[model samples]
Target chain A: MLRKLFKFHGGVKPQTNKTESTTQPIAQVPLPDRLVIPLHQAVGGHPRPLVAPGDKVFKGQRIGGADGSLSSAVHASTSGIVHDVVPALMPHTSGLTTLSVIIEPDGEDRWGELDKVNYRRTPPDELRDFLRDAGVVGLGGAVFPSYAKLKPGKEGRLKTLVINGAECEPFITCDDLLMRERAADMLKGIVAMRHMLQAEEVLIGIEDNKPEAVAAVQAAIAASGQSGIEAVAIPTRYPAGGAKQLIRVLTGIEVPHGRRSTDFGVQCFNVGTAYSIYEALELGRPLISRVVTVAGNVDRPRNYEVLIGTPMDHVVRQSGARPDSDRYIMGGPMMGVRLPAFGVPVVKATNCILVGSPALFPPPPPEMPCIRCGECAKACPADLAPFEMYWFSRSKNFGKAQEYHLFDCIECGCCSFVCPSHIPLVDYFRFSKSEIWARERDKEASDAARDRFEFKNFRQEREKQEKAEKLAAKAAATREKVAAEGQAGTTSAAAETPDVAAKPAAPSAEDTKRALIAAAMEKARQQKAQVAPKNTEQLSTETQADIAAIEARRAAAATPPTPDA
Target chain B: MLTALLVMTAVALVLGALLGYASLKFKVEGDPLVEKIDAILPQTQCGQCGFPGCRPYATAIASGEADINQCPPGGEEGIRKLADLLGREFKSLSEEHGVEKPKSVAVIDENTCIGCTLCIQACPVDAIVGAAKQLHTVVAGECTGCELCVAPCPVDCIAMEPIVDTLDTWKWRYPVIQIKQAA
Candidate 1:
């Protein structure tokens, strides 16, 4: 057991409402009539749907293939027929819908062909590809593609693989129960990842609060004969589950800004992610179902092996939520999003579903002016000046807020939890970030429009200048020819012959060439301005050689016959 | 007398040398973490907490310049985190800083809005953009709902509305627990 040395910024010990639902083993929720499986379950781009409409899919069958390097494939959670590939309800706070494979379950949970690949002999890159194909992602709050994090940096110095057991978020014990029950499987997952990453050390950092979990993990590690794996118990604190915080606590390294821990020769994976990795590698199972903790003011607080995209209302109903339930939150209370309605599906990021009455976490205290007591500054865990952020956020100074590192605030609710004024500090920061992002998007759009306009204007101006120059040169050439004809004692009628014969054709051709040049220049301006141009039509190219030749011949020939000046 | 004077001078110089060496060796390098900690502060120029701005407040928090409870904008979460970061005892957000409210962004009712650009001038973040005497519109996404614009609006077209949580805008809210399920 190791004690935490570097004190983090701010946190609060909220009422540990964890025991209410964890007494019973994980229960399997009854299958819903329709399963709306999202194509983009894990972070990154949406997977390409493999099974079209009306295609029959078995339980654990791949229905969507990975579309990008940073995406995961989508699988059928149960044996069902594809009802429709439509924009279905997703478990998101934004309330925006995403494409989902709506399947009407046949009630028979029959699995598809299991590809039992011998992962031991398989290359690490191949194993990673297999996992990605199987649609595995971090079961932690972040549903980032797991395989993406597996690859080492450019140096390929993979040293330690830390299994995060820090269920620091109050009311989340899904990982704990999983460790207690399926620790050996979790170990297998760890070993699989270790082999793939070629990590020398595997450390499972569990909170000391869960002694049972620690013991279970330790026993599992021992039974697996894994000398490389060590279960290290650390002090339980809020945000301990944070990857950066856990990495700091375990190895004493801060994940530098905008870089993954893998960059610094350390790879951190959630215990749940490790377990999923095991299932994918050994059991040939895709990430179809996961253990979700259903707790809070519900009648039954228990963990359930729920299908992905199972609506919160279904889970709440199964848990016997109170009749007058005012709020249903997905994930731990400290940072869980409140569902506007219970219809939001269970996403990969969901760890817990909290159904609570007003009495449990009372509505925050009535708005009060800040007392200038310097309390919020004392409570922030990210070392942020919550008070200052609040002022800037309130004053609508998003730039100032960002300069204060508004993006760094994890929205842990610790500041709001401890505010004497009962101020919802996280809300303000969230608002500020949203505003800043909005402004950035607006500025980008406007900048693009302005660039286009400026480019168009420049092309037009250049075309006008070039056209004027050409017309002047043509007129000058005609006058010089006329003068030369008169000086050479030829008839004025002879000089007029060429001008009369070629005038219409020449002007028309010149006009067309000028127009083309103008168009090309406009397009070139666009191409130059764009970050990435998909086609060449946007580029405006001018024929410089022809114009240069014309000018050069005219300058040298004086009044003698010049070729098409 | 010469010997005594030499001995006294030698002792004085030796003592001075020792003191200077001690000062150089043990000149406490103030906490290296203060600047980073300060960088996280909300740089709201509004001195509602009595500090000139966010950095001063951060310095006060880090170097014990001011109490962590002073900022109203930071609220409870800010105070607790600061305490954790600075290794200070966690106190509630100062009552004087102001109560936390549902985040609202400014919205301009285009129909009701006159060409007055007072709200534009009042916005600290430059969230509002419109020419003087031109029809003004509130960029809902950019408006932080600080309410500074609300006060400055001559026609009272600007209203602070709670940011509608849409699917894209919705982030996973941290879950509150009643029991710790042992993993």
Candidate 2:
């Protein structure tokens, strides 16, 4: 059957250096003295370390448990004693370190207990959990947990399953070699995934440049006698291997921004991921090793099936990298980041270790001002306005950059690869994205603070009002009690003497005033009597007569003076 | 002329009555201006703005009783917001209130805590949780870092710790310019 293919917008075809690596078969590297596996190999929450320091662990035993539903577990690559669980350098553009479990290999390489379950008999959800425990994730540079992609969407079942074998990036041929050597195992994994997703059709899309891979996958499909699986050759284009691009090519579906491809009844997985799933289910193996392509400036470039935590320096030394190779990149030239140091451990996302020299990757030319050339826009795979976004980002105008759909850029480096000005366009986009995320976090914190403050104010006001209300209530009660006591006193007085109550209702104002005046006059008279000559009785008789004579004279003088006035 | 004067007088009377009825029918009830002002003030409720709380400060601002710069917790950015909202001139936060500091949360030294409920009673936000004569701890999530609880602690066990930046909160710094060696 002829499968219809669709074209996506804006792609660049760089010189393909994939032939050097594919010239040799995938080789297996011996276990190093130690392994330093990072707990966060997939694109989700970091897994929690299960093996503590000084604990002996067996090969295939879980070293880290899945942190959440979206995370994948990590397993011991070889039988060893855990030396330490500490933060170690990881292969990231930011040159940051993550929590890693370092194990000193015991040189035994013994296998642990294996429990192989029939995936067909197992429920779909349980199968997904099994794959998660197996630490299966997308091996196509994304490292997204594979079980997440296996679950069906609201439509209840996936209509189409896409197997991306399009090893489209230059100097990265891990997937190509994977398809050539392990096509049957990949097909088995695909069958298992199809069973889990209940997908109707499986489309394996490989770029036409990798004719051998396409042929091998075709032969595998024929040998398996799978009616629904079809191996189709897509055109060779940079980033044609991007999940969305390959999905569009095979299914003729454009996955809109912010919506998953499963929404269109289509789901995509890497061929390497499919192989890992097969190994995990059929052999009861946990993912501890992957095929890594070592190329660029090395005397002999090839793909090696390297353990997950092998140091990059060890891999480079094994690859016979030239003395003049000054830098190392972890992906294709178009989208790879320079290694901070060569000793960082290999992560699940490390597909290609491109050794850099002055000859192969010359330092980028001095950046010139943008000449308003539309080449970047023409080469943008997502069809974004790179120059406009660059302008806004350069000026730190994040809002305007967001208006131009800055986050839609996948940072595929297509625009940067084709720019005449030699501007690092993707770097700008990354900066804008990180800035936006930081601003969002700040806004969230501020919002939380504001909420707490507002609640505090509200509570304080309520408590104050409550205190005032209680005081008012207490005052009102006291007044009521006092009035009741006064009423009781009046009632008791009336009950004791009815005649007293009838005496002009206790006394009128004039009568009370007259009585008060009469009492005051009588008290005054008594006071004058006491002050008069009461002590004179005890005095001598002559003294008393003299006192009387003085009083009589004073009285006569007073009477005459009053008459004259 | 007399008929014209009578007609104009009747028209004026009818319009006046209609206007009076409309005023009664469409009178706005609440003080929306105060709410608008309150929305702009950082609701710290620290009482540094001389008012008892944010709402009261907002009310004072809306009524032109308080200056827009009096809220130190609101800081300069908050004052700008209020200025923009009220169409007033922007001014620096008043130094009399307090100096603006980084967001912090209160932590209690449990060992030294005297179990005196003074800190709990001092906390304006009720963020402290404990009973009388019991070790009180601040609910860190709810603490506004107002620093009101620190002074009233008899043992001086409460400390205001500034929130630290972690990997999740780390912002991307500007990329340093790489100078290429002349080859």
Q: Report the lDDT of model 2 for residue A532.
A: 73
Compose the digit string of candidate 1's lDDT tens values, residues B19-40.
9999999988667666665544
- Name the fnat for model 1: 0.05
lDDT of candidate 2 over A256-292, digit per residue (tens): 7899888899999999999999999999998988999
Best TM-score among the predictions, by candidate number? 2
Candidates' lDDT values, in order? 0.75, 0.84
lDDT of 1 by residue, A358-391 (tens): 8877876465766766777777777878988888
Off by over 4 Å in 1: A1-6, A462-565, B1-183
TM-score of predicted chain A against the true chain A, for each candidate: 0.82, 0.84
Worst 10 residues of 2 chain A by lDDT: A508-517
Q: How well docked is model 1, in DockQ terms?
A: 0.03
